[model samples]
Target: MRTAKDRLRHTILFELLGLVTVTPLAALILNKDMGRIGALAVAISLLAMATNYVFNLAFDHALVRMGRPVNVRPPWMRALHAVLFEATLMLITLPIVAWWLNMSLWQALATDVGFALFYLAYAYVYNWAYDRVFPMPSAVRIKAADR
Candidate 1:
């Protein structure tokens, strides 16, 4: 299991990097004002950040229970992780984005789907990089194995 601080750091960095990468692209693709897109992006980022912490903790625990090493997921598992995270997040964020942007549900869903696809790729790469950079401490891994 990761410490609260580690989780916090992961969430913060994930959102910060995502916001930087996605904001301008979303603005350009969506053809909306940057400020409007930025605000929506920030709202989505904040929600995703909170959801990420909780979801990752649960995911890690599930992996440990299943006798998988949390830090060394298989590629298939990594794909599942990204898809599951975005699927859940899209559910929570779609309505919020529609309300904030005053768009119809269909429009919101389309927009959210676009974000989801980007995040699916982003999450896969980000987690792969993050694991390499900040591996699970050996002590934590050993303890998880003991379970």
Candidate 2:
């Protein structure tokens, strides 16, 4: 499990990197001014920061409760994690995206889906790398046999 400080650091880094990479690209792709796109991206990033911290913490806890190994994420687990995270964020951000961009709901859905796809991959790779760089705490649990 990550300490609060560690989770904060991860959230900040994730949003910062995501903003830097995605904001400009979204602007160009959507034919919107950078300011509008940047504002929207930053706003969503803020929401995502909160989401990321809570979601990751809850996710790890869920894994542990299910008797799964933390930090040693199998590929399938990583995929599921990424998909679920993106889905959660998509639901939270859809209305915001529609309102911010003055877009129709369907348009917002399309645009948000694009963002979700990018983030789904980004979350997977970023987490894999982050875990390698700042590995999760080793478990305190011992097998019943060992006990």
Candidate 3:
């Protein structure tokens, strides 16, 4: 398991990197002013940051409870993790996106789906890289024991 401080760092880095990459792309793709898209992105990012922190901590704890190694996830588990995270986030963001963009529920669902797809992919890759770069302490112990 990771410390609270480590999880905070992870959430911050993930949000910052995501905002930097996604904001411009969203603005360009939506043909909206950057300010509007940027504001929406920032709002969503704040919500996501909170969700990311809580969700990841809970997820790691759940894994430990189930006798699974947090950092030694298989691809299927990784996919499930990303899907679950995005699904939760989508439920929370749908109405917000609809209000912000002045779109119908269906339109917002479509837009939210687009964002979810991006995050689904992003979360998977980011987690894979994050785990490799900063293996959990338990993972480190397990790896050392194997040697």
Candidate 4:
């Protein structure tokens, strides 16, 4: 498990890097103004940062209870979770994204999917690197075991 401060760092770094990389690409691919794309990206990133905290806390708690924590998530489970999360996010942001870009709902949906794909990959890589760089504290391991 990560400390709150560490998690905040992770969220900030992840979103910052993502915004730098994705905003331009999104603008080009979606043929939208950079300001629109960048604004949307910032809003989405902030929301995702909040969601990241909640989701990871919940997942860690569940894993501790399960006892077999910290390994590769099953492919099916990963896919399911990713799809559900993306769909929920799409619902929340579609109207905003659409209105911002002056696009239709379907256009927004497609754009959202593109962004989701980028994030899905970014998440996997970020987490892998984060674990390597800042692993769970031994205290957390001990706590997990005691639970």
Candidate 5:
């Protein structure tokens, strides 16, 4: 339901803020160099940015078809969706992250989980703030409700 420009803004802001937060935290937590953490974070952020665009588009389309509005997802549904999405993304990113950082696969998995937890919370808060700060236009909201 978001315009392309809005979605682009979301992607950029999400990644930028995430990089700012995650790099330092990852370095501190994992006892890695800042350069390593920053590189890994950037790689993951790029992958996530692409995935975010596709996943959101699909999710919105499904919601519309299911007569579900965008504002509130059921708690259980959100939990399941978030966990599944993170898990799938971790699988895709873990190897690259580990290889880049010269870590074992298990280490990578654990590290990825740590980041995922952070992002899960970040995404929830970010989206809540995003909606409040840049709410859907009144016309679109009315049209969506009428449907």
Candidate 6:
């Protein structure tokens, strides 16, 4: 398990890095001004930050309940997590994306799917790196050892 402070740090770093990388790419790909894309990026990032914090907390708790080490998510679990995260995020962002870019729902869905795909890959890699860089305390293992 990680402390609240650690989770907060993780969320902040993830969002900041994502924004830096995604904003320019989104603008270029969409043929929009950087400011417009940047604003949208920031908005989506804010929503994601909140979701990331809550989702990860719940995910760790699920691992604990399942007798799995909180620090080590299996590949299957990681994939599921990334997929679910992106799916939910895309749903939330689709309307906002359409409004911001003045696109129809179908266009927004297409654009959102692209964003989701990028994030699906990004989330997997980012989490792998994050876990390596800031390993979580293995509460489950430690508890089992005491038994």
For candidate 4, write residues 1-147 as lDDT tens digits: 667898888778878998899989988997878997888889888887788777766766776678645444555655555566566667778888888778899988888888888877777676668667877665546454455
Q: What value does the lDDT take at residue 101 in candidate 2?
A: 96
Report how far residue 95 has shifted in candidate 5, in Å.
0.8
Model 4: which ten-residue window has the lowest total lDDT? 138-147
TM-score of candidate 1 versus the correct structure, residues matched by position: 0.91
Off by over 4 Å in 4: 70-85, 138-147
What TM-score does structure 3 among the candidates reach?
A: 0.91
Candidate ordering by lDDT (highest first): 2, 6, 1, 3, 5, 4
Instruction: List model 3 lDDT by residue over 44-67, tens digit each.
Output: 999999999999888876876676
How do all models score by TM-score?
Answer: 0.91, 0.92, 0.91, 0.81, 0.86, 0.91
Full-model lDDT for every candidate: 0.88, 0.89, 0.87, 0.75, 0.81, 0.88
lDDT of 6 at 63: 71
Q: What ranges in model 2 sit over 4 Å off?
A: 141-147
Ranked by TM-score, the better of candidates 4 and 6 is 6
Q: How well does candidate 5 score on lDDT at residue 130?
A: 81
Better of 4 and 6 by lDDT: 6
In model 2, which residue pairs have backbone atoms overlapping below 3 Å? Answer: none
Best by TM-score: 2
**Clash count, candidate 5:** 0
Better of 1 and 4 by TM-score: 1
Q: Report the number of clashing residue pairs per model.
A: 0, 0, 0, 0, 0, 0
